[model samples]
Target: SQTIHQWPATLVQPVGSPLSLECTVEGTSNPNLYWYRQAAGRGLQLLFYSVGIGQISSEVPQNLSASRPQDRQFILSSKKLLLSDSGFYLCAWSGSGNTIYFGEGSWLTVV
Candidate 1:
């Protein structure tokens, strides 16, 4: 049984402050991990993806970064926050197919 866990169910921060969101996969090997954001009434947007540890691909240029320090661990961070960054964040993983599994997700509202 595989599972994904994302932390900080919700967050509220001021602009220019730091932010960190974490996600981890369990019971899977060499899984493809991804980070995505969804705006209100909008479709999900891919932020980052990792094929393996230390390998990250950014889908868009923004104030966020993703890192894979361990095989099952993925971290998303921002040195400074922006009001435009407010949205719903999701961490997911896929296992060689179209079936993508996601975590509980995190909501960010920057003021």
Candidate 2:
């Protein structure tokens, strides 16, 4: 059984602070990992994705960046936070099919 883990479950940060959100996939090898963000009531937006370690693709340009330092570990980071960066961030993975599973998600509030 493959599963994705993301944390922290919630975060409160001031504007201009740094941010780091971690996600990892268990029980799978070389799976496609993705970082998606959903605003208060908006649809999920693809921020970044990785097909392999050290290989990342950005879907949109923003204040955040993603890295896959290890095979199954994906990280999202921001050097400086912004009020517009507040949202529900979800980590997801897909393996061998169209089905993608998501984590419990992290709620970020920038004050």
Candidate 3:
């Protein structure tokens, strides 16, 4: 079965600092990878998706960016974090857009 892993279950960052969050999947190959951010109780907001290595699509343009270095490794990075950049970061994988499964997620707070 496919599964994802994200670290620092929770994080606190200062304004203007850099941020890097990692996500990887096991048991599957060439999965449709995605990155999402959830604000409070709101629904998931698509940030990026990758069809393959070094291939990414951004759904939003903000203080964030994403990269897919390897087939199953996805990374989210920001050079300068903003207070508004704080939120729940999630990584998901699916064979198709029909359905998806996610990682446990990382909670980030910028102060």
Candidate 4:
């Protein structure tokens, strides 16, 4: 019964504005959490991941950062937004298995 939730489901922000996307996992403890971005017609890119509280790994150098303030809570943020930052953001969680569950996803449009 584990689930991942992310929000706001859709966003439209101006360039140079700050951004914050939050994700949380339920019905599981110490699950691996991840943030992924998929540009239009592109494959999913691993952004950040967390194995435990206060532990975060960045898969690529980007304009965003992630934080694991709690065991099941992960936050993705950027001090300023970029036009290239527009994309679909997904929050995922995985238990001790290879199976991963994804959220409904968030659509970000930087104008």
Candidate 5:
């Protein structure tokens, strides 16, 4: 395995709507999972990360939050959406080195 899975591959929401993104990694143990966002023409920006179960770190101050409900699962959620929050969201995981794997990604467009 060593694969990453994410849901709601694409989304279109009105401003002020709520959003949730889920991800899971398989075939690995205690992997470092990350949540990232990419804008129209910008690079990936780290939003949150987790080293282990119940260990989450936020890199930016925004409406986004993350959780590790299980050892292999990571979640990203927002209670209220903003136009600026629309972007390409990605879930990734890494082992003990520089190698990292990313999910198929979720694209969000706010109207």
Candidate 6:
């Protein structure tokens, strides 16, 4: 019975503004957390994942970073956003090899 929550629903930032997106999961502890981005019909690309606290694996090097401070809380951040960063930001949760469920996401548009 795990569910994920991601917020702001939508975000608009300038080319150099900072960014923060939060995701949390209830009903599960130490669940694998994932951050993904989909741009204009493209597939989901993994940004980062954490199997446990202070353990984050990043799949791409960009204007983004992820952290896991709690067993079920995850965050995605950027010191300075970019126009190319505009996309659908998704947070996913899975326990072990189970299928992942995604949140509604925060649509980011950098001007």
What lDDT does each candidate get? 0.96, 0.96, 0.92, 0.94, 0.93, 0.92
Query: Residue 16's C-alpha lDDT in candidate 5?
Result: 88
Clashing pairs in 1: none
Consecutive 10-residue window with the lowest summed lDDT within model 6:
95-104
lDDT of 6 at 81: 92
Name the regions of candidate 6 deviating beyond 4 angstroms. none
Q: Write the per-residue lDDT of candidate 1 for residues 8-83, one digit (tens) a residue.
A: 9999999999999999999999999999999998889999999999999999999999999999999999999999
Candidate 3's TM-score reads 0.94
Question: lDDT of model 3 at residue 38?
Answer: 95
State the TM-score for model 2: 0.97
User: How do the residues 1-111 of candidate 4 rate in per-residue lDDT, one tens digit apiece?
Assistant: 787899999999999999999999899999999999999788999999898999999999999999999999999999999999999999999999978899999999999
- What residue pairs are clashing in model 3? none
Worst 10 residues of 1 by lDDT: 95-104
Distance from true location, Cα of 110 in model 3, Å = 0.4
Task: Quantify how close model 4 is to the true structure by its C-alpha RMSD in Å.
Answer: 0.7
What TM-score, over all chains together, does every model reach? 0.97, 0.97, 0.94, 0.97, 0.96, 0.95
Residue 19 deviation, candidate 5, in Å? 0.7
TM-score of 6: 0.95
Clash pairs detected, candidate 4 = none
